[model samples]
Target chain A: MLVHAGNSRGAMRGERLCPAEVKRGLLDGNPWQADPSLANLSGVADALAGNGPAHRIIIDATASGEVADYHAHWLEQGIHVVTACKLGSGTTLERWRAINDAVARGNARYGDSATVGAGLPLLRNIRDLQAGGDTIHSIAGVLSGSLAWLFNHYDGQQPFSQLVLQAKDAGYTEPDPREDLSGDDVRRKILILARAAGVPLASDEVAVDSLLELAADGASADAGLEALDAPMAERFEAASAAGAQLGFIARLQDGRARVGLERLDATHPLAGGAGTDNRVAIWSDRYCDQPLVIQGPGAGAGVTAAGLLDDALRIARSTPD
Target chain B: MLVHAGNSRGAMRGERLCPAEVKRGLLDGNPWQADPSLANLSGVADALAGNGPAHRIIIDATASGEVADYHAHWLEQGIHVVTACKLGSGTTLERWRAINDAVARGNARYGDSATVGAGLPLLRNIRDLQAGGDTIHSIAGVLSGSLAWLFNHYDGQQPFSQLVLQAKDAGYTEPDPREDLSGDDVRRKILILARAAGVPLASDEVAVDSLLELAADGASADAGLEALDAPMAERFEAASAAGAQLGFIARLQDGRARVGLERLDATHPLAGGAGTDNRVAIWSDRYCDQPLVIQGPGAGAGVTAAGLLDDALRIARSTPD
Candidate 1:
């Protein structure tokens, strides 16, 4: 049953967006929702609300701020939420607490399985560990798929600039590339993971050692890419000489979160990944000696879709038909 | 809310035992009635049935055949089950299927989290992976905490039999130490894991490579411990010379479950464990590149108690108060 469909870009709404039309529309980019205005997003919520009770909303949009606001509202209305957006869960400690409180108040489930590790069960694992009476001491990982791919391949073999350009061309990095290089995404992921481990952390609280400072002000993508070569080359060269690999690592420990590039030895848990793989090692009271590690492709459209569906199916199975 | 309590050893019935009393009783072993005979087991069930419609049974007994039989009956009565017994989940495929059918028919939850990997989330992880549409290619690990401790400590520096004796003394192994060496527990665990991964495997169907063959039939504990020295010495020496550590590994792959001794390097997921720690690595499509690895203390009285409570609390939270 198609309840309601609205696209921000093109004029498609109500009668025009049947099940078939919506399916075809989602096949490509968000032509209908290029600029997801507040009216368009609220239109989605209003349509879902009109459908009565027991409705589930799958938020695949990355606008965490707007999506989280709607998520809180919908959850308060006893509607379930499954999201791939980290911003909803990763924005601020206050918002995080609000979402949780809303879900509790309405007895709704908020599925954030795809928010951190794509389709991997990193958040769920952390939650289960906590439920099992395991005190999670720390979590460290290479979280960003784009950053992991770039670092894993950028061993001073070729100019680091070329790899950054190649990664951008491969659709691995954000279009601006600066967004990924800024370390904000990794910081958000670390905070998300930290929250899952029972740590309520605000966005600005995380200490992010970014590589974006190397890029000069008002530099274009090409200029920024070229400027990063010298510094990155030195970092990679030093790491190799020390028998260590350079990894963009995120660590949450002792009530603090840190994200930065680190020199990891071969034996380190986060030291291995082929391409765009996110590997996390969680050290806890129960898993104290050898941390529980989960590694896999952390990003990509296919995996994100799988994660969203997985969360939806989970809610469906648990919710009464 | 003291419902009922009984030990197979003595006549302590009709009066409900308090939490402290039950703790004291468990300290000495199962003695409320010594032998968990069929009639006594049935009587316990009957007493619980008299309580009310919605009842949850926590079976901490090791009597696989009997507990599973009763688990089916209780579940059919709409009574939930939280258990630390592997037999209920690890028995023959037919019995396993029967229990599952009972759970489904009664719409009752079966808590099997503590059955394998002691308190670790091995079974749950496998189930979640399957539910998330990820195909598990294979699973391999050091599942037995007693064996993990034994192998981890035994480096040919001291007599292997002495380490076995120490492990037994520390309450790490089954009373008959032969049970640990027999690989039956590991086989059951592998079968439990394989079933959780969507493979309906019979208990006997597993190709378990046993170490018990070294001990003569009807040998005493001392005699068996003595007989194990020479073969174990040779094995450890060989493993050391080859620069590999010996691990009692359980593997389920290509629709086959195997349990036996194998050599593992430091890089192996199951290689590192201080004392009675169980480590597992799961390979699936989502986690295809590098296996999802979980490591922790696999066995201990305190840890097992924690697992049972954890499972019970999970069931309690899910079920209506």
Candidate 2:
């Protein structure tokens, strides 16, 4: 049973709450009343403190850095933290080190599987390979689902801006398509993967080639979008003439990370993925000749939630009474 | 830190043994002396006992059912078992149940990642998906490294028998190539995956269309292999005419499992793999339209050892002090 629930909005004691009902109420925009005594993170933490020996877990489904900030504290208190937020391990190296140190100091588990590639087992595979004494030489992937969709559907016939608009309309991109086009999301993902592969890559160390720069400032949004057409079309046609496909790739090799648009051969590992699929290739000592490739739907609420639940189940099962 | 070691041939206490020395000795075909007191399984088990609070693990690298029989006993005694052998979960349903029950009863881990895709995260993904409440609809793959190589390399140009000989020469097939041609290994893999997906499919329930049946018996081994050429060539031609590729496929759907040669379209998820890659496509409620695909080199001694080491590390890390 759930003992406590909290979000950026508020916190509540979940002793009287039914999970199914709570889910329905939230989905229907008729949420249960928040407790006056449990309206903040500190209140929720206090309520979660005295829950006997049963394993305590905090499922952070939000993208808030505020929530991620408490991950170390919660873990240091012997509470397991299962998070979908990237700020935990994808941000500053200091925070990542703190979390690891806290986990060791308090003997807690940190489940961040949902932070990268949704639930595709990318991070787990990297960590496991490292644990097994395999040296990871490089890692590359189409890390962003929105960019993948845009690139996969972008043809020279249709303006790239039109495809971006369609992707936005389809709810595939962020509200501001610029956020998706800026290439920062892919950068974060690469940092997360690189760090997992034992590379200490800072956010600034990654060189990003932003798609947003292809557009020009104009009085209207559509006009600004039109400036992107010629540049994108030229790149696409050049790639096509060379018998290659264009992909927004995030790569970490020799401890340096980069995210950019690149033309890849038809036989390239990243070029084979279908619509919106995030394809990751890992080059390690064990898989040096032919890299291990994992491809799947990389962005979905259901999958992310499932990843969180999977982590929770693992913690619950691995913990002894 | 090595405590006890045993194999079908003998056993030894590792008090005076260095792991690097042992590895070099075995590779040089000059092994350390075996202790007579630790020459058998029971003797090794007795020595493994009374190791205080440190996590105990038994790494099974052999393909012997006799060794598998002791898995439950070891697990029940709170000794974790990390294995590359298939007998633990790929054999009888009773043995599978016994192992799982023993894990629960003894609070021990059973690391069988090496049993499936040589540590490609196939089993981990399936089990995690189930744990997270996702309903798996189906799973299909080209499972056998030997068969994958044969089919991937077999064009109508070369006789199938010649390719089999080449595969054998390349160390890609079993000593008796018929063991690979029999489809039983694929059957075991399918059974293991199906069981992981919550389908309790018995071994006999799987309908295996063995490729061995296509060859006729002859006085000479080469003559018997020659009989396989025509049928395979015809199938190859037929598939090529349809713009499809032939793959040795193992599939589980609707709680039924089957292993056979399949013709797949270019767009099929499992059709894109190259060389001896084991490509598995998983269909689940979360991945309904596009199956999650994992592809990689499925067989190698280094990878198998890395997988065993990975499982051992996980058991060690997850266990509380």
- After TM-score superposition, what is the CA distance of residue B227 in candidate 1 from its true location, in Å? 7.9
Error of 2 at A150 (Å): 2.4
lDDT of 2 by residue, B94-186 (tens): 988899899878578999999988877789878777777789999999989899989878878989999999999999999989889989998
Q: lDDT for model 1, on a 0 to 1 scale?
A: 0.76
Query: What C-alpha lDDT does candidate 2 achieve relative to the native structure?
Result: 0.83
iRMSD, all candidates: 3.4, 1.7
Q: Please, what are the lDDT tens digits per residue for candidate 2 over residues A177-272?
A: 888888988988999899888888888999999877776554256676778888899999999999988999999998888999999986687777
Give the top-scoring candidate (DockQ): 2
lDDT of 1 by residue, B1-321 (tens): 445554444323333556676656644665653334523666665655664435456455454566566777677766677777888878788778877898777567888877887677778778877887889989998889889889878878687789988998888888888789989889988988888888888888898888766654656767877777778888878888887789999998899889998988755655655677787888888666666777667786656666777777787777776
TM-score of chain A of 2: 0.94
Candidate 1 per-residue C-alpha lDDT over A1-321 given as tens digits, one digit per residue, 9 for 90 to 100: 445443434324453236566656544544654223523665565655554436455455464466567777777767678888887778888878888899778567898988887877788888877887779999999899999999878869788878888999999998888789889998988988898788888899999988877654646757877788888888888989999889889999899999998999875666665688888888887666666777778888877877887888788787776
Clashing residue pairs in candidate 2 (N, C-alpha, C atoms within 3 angstroms): none
Relative to the unseen true structure, what is the C-alpha lDDT of residue B271 in candidate 2, on a scale of 0 to 100?
A: 82
